[model samples]
Target: MKDTFSSAAAARQAAQSEMQKVDRGAATLSQALGLGRPHLMPQAAVTVEGFKPEIDSEDWLVKSVEHTLGDGGFTTHIELERQGDGNARDQEDVEDLVNDPKK
Candidate 1:
C-alpha cells in the first residue's frame, strides 16, 4: 500500500512538471506569433449609425459587423460595445440588463 501511494505521488509530480514545461512552451510560441499581449479594444470614438436595439437603452453601442459566406450559408456577426467608465463588472451588469425581459 505504501509503495502504491509513493508511486502515485511520483506520477503526480511528473505530470505537474510536464504541464509547467508545456505552459512555458505555449508562452514562447505566443511571443513568437506576436500574441503575447492582450488585444486592444476599439476606440471610443468609433460609432455605427442606424442601429436599432430591441431594448430601449443608451448604454450599449454596436461596435462592428462581420459578414461571411461559405458552403454552410451566409452568417452575420455583430459585436456590441458597452459605454462606461467602469470595469468588467459594469459590462456584466449591462449585459444582464439587456438580456433581462423585466428591464
Candidate 2:
C-alpha cells in the first residue's frame, strides 16, 4: 500500500515503520466474522489476539472493510490479506506445517 504525504520526510517515516509484515491469508482466525452494521472501514485499527509467540500477532491493522446490505444475504463476497516478512517467514510457515503432526 502507498500513500501521499505532504513532505518527503513523512514518507520516509512511513516506509521505515511498515517494513515488517505478517501474512494471515492462510490462517483461519483472521477471517472476518460476519460484520454487523457499517461501522469499520479501511485503515481502521482492530486488535487481534494472536496465537504464536512472534508469528501470530495482535498488531493487526485493517487493510479494507466491506459492509453490505441486500435481499436475504449480501449475495456477494469479500477480499482480505495479511502481510508476512517477505520470503523467509513463508518458508518457515511451510516447514512448520510439514513438521507439525497435531494439525
TM-score of each: 0.24, 0.38
Which candidate ranks first by TM-score, i.e. highest?
2
Error of 2 at 99 (Å): 41
lDDT of 2 by residue, 1-103 (tens): 2466565556544443443443444332334445443555554555545457653554344566565666545422223345433442454444443344233
Task: After the best TM-score superposition of candidate 1, give how far the Cα of residue 49 lies from its true spot, in angstroms.
Answer: 21
CA RMSD of all predictions: 19.1, 12.3
**Residue 5 deviation, candidate 2, in Å?**
15
What is the C-alpha local distance difference test score of each model? 0.37, 0.45
- lDDT of model 2 at position 76: 22
Local accuracy of candidate 1 as per-residue lDDT tens digits, 1-103:
1122234446444444444343332211001112221232333223333445532333443344445566646554545454433332344444443344233
